[model samples]
Target: MDLLVETFFNLAIMREALPLLLRGVLTTLALCAVVIPLGFAGGLVLAVLGTTRSRWKRFLLACWIDFFRAVPPLVLLIFVHSGLPFAGIELTAFAAVAVAFLLNNSAYYAEIVRAGIESIGRGQREAARSTGLTATQTLTWVVLPQAVRNVLPDLLSNTIEVVKLTSIASVVALPELLYAADMARSVTYNASPIVLAAGFYLLLLWPVVRLLSRLEHRIAG
Candidate 1:
C-alpha cells in the first residue's frame, strides 16, 4: 500500500507539480476560449451556406465538410504545424492548433447546427416571412432560436468533447494540462502528477456531465 501510494499519490510530488499544472490549465482554457468561438462561427456560416439552392455549391460545401471530418484532428494539426512550412506558410504552435481545431470542429458543429435547423418546420419560416421579415431575419428570429434550443444538449455535449480534445494540443508541445503532467512525471519519476491531472480533469468536466444528464432528461420529459 505504501509503495502504491508513493508511486501514484505522493503529496510532495503533487505539490511540486501544482504551479506548472495550473499554468497548463490556464493555457488549456485560453485555447478553448479561442477555438470554440471560431469553430462555432465558422460552422454557423457553413450551415447557413448549406441552405443554398445551388446544387454545385452544395456539392462543394459537402465535400469540404466531409474532407475535414474524415481527417483525424491530430493528423490535421501535425500537417498544419509541420507540413505547411513546405508551402511557405509557417504557423506557431498555438496558431496551428487553432487552425486545425477550427477546421475539424467546424465540421462537427455544422452537422449539429444542420440537424437543429432541419428540425424547424417549413411553416414557421413562411409565417415569419409573411410578417415582412427577410429570409435572414426569419432565420435569425424564428428559425435559429428554436433550432438552437432543440439542439442545446447536443451543442453542450460537443463543447465538452472539444474541451477534452484540447489535450491533443500537447502533441505540438503547447504545454497543455496533459503535457505539463507528463513533464512533471518525467522530472519526478512518479505517476502522481498524472493522477493529479486526472483529478483536475474530473473536477473540470464532472459538473458539465451532470448538467448534460439533467438537460437530456428535461428534453425527454
Candidate 2:
C-alpha cells in the first residue's frame, strides 16, 4: 500500500497535476454550457420544422439529420478540424470541436424531440382545436408541455452523455480533462493521473446518472 500511495496519492504530484486538471474541467464545462443548449435548440427547431405541412421541407431536414446522425463523432471532429481547411474554411481546434459536437448532438436531440412530440395523442390536438386555439398556441400551450414532461428524464440522460462525450475533444488538443491527464501522465511517467481523471469523470457523472434514475422511477410511478 505504501507504493500505491506513493504513486497515486503523493502530495507533490497532486499539487502539480490538480490545477491543470481543474482548468481542463473548466474548459469542458464551458463547452458543455454552450453545446447543450445550442444543440437542444437546434434539434427543437428541426423537430418543429419537421412537423410542417410541407413534404419537401420535411424530407430535406430528415436527410440532413440522418447524415449527421450516421457519421461518427470522432470522424466528424477530424473532418471539420482537418478537412475544412482544404475547402477554404479555417477553424481553431476548439471551434472544430464545437461544430462537430453541435452537429452530432443536434441530430440525437432532434430524434428524441421527434419521439416526444409524436408520443402525444392526436386527440389532444383535436381538443385544442375545439377550444379555438391556433395551431401554434396549441403546440406551445398544450401538446408540447405534456410531451416535454414525458421526455424530460431522457433529455437529462442525454445531457450526461454529452458531458462524457466532451472528453473526445482531447484528440484535438483542446486541453480538456482527458488531455490534461495525458499530459500529467507523460510528465510523471505514472498511470495515476489517468486514474485520477477517471475518478473526476465518475465524480462528475455519477450524481447525474443517479438523478436520472430517480426521475425515471418517479415518472414511472
On residues 1-221, what C-alpha lDDT tens digit does candidate 1 reach at each position? 99999999999999999999999898988999999999998888889889888999999999999999999999999999999999999999999999999999999999899899999999999999998999999988999889889998998899999999999999999999999999999999999999999898889889999999999999999
Alpha-carbon lDDT of model 2: 0.88
Query: What's the C-alpha lDDT at position 161 in model 2?
Result: 88
Runs of candidate 2 with Cα error greater than 4 angstroms are 1-11
What's the true lDDT of residue 61 in model 2?
93
Superposed by TM-score, candidate 2 places the C-alpha of residue 59 at a distance from the truth, in angstroms, of 2.2
lDDT of 1: 0.94
Clashing pairs in 2: none
Ten residues in sequence with the least summed lDDT for candidate 2: 7-16
Query: What is the C-alpha lDDT profile of model 2 across 1-221, one tens digit per residue?
Result: 98998877766776778888888888888888888898898888888888899999999999999999999999999999989999999899889998998999988888888889999999999999999999988988988788778898988988898899999999988998999989998998776787788888999889989999999999899
Roughly what TM-score does model 2 have, to 2 decimal places? 0.92
C-alpha RMSD by candidate, in order: 0.8, 1.7
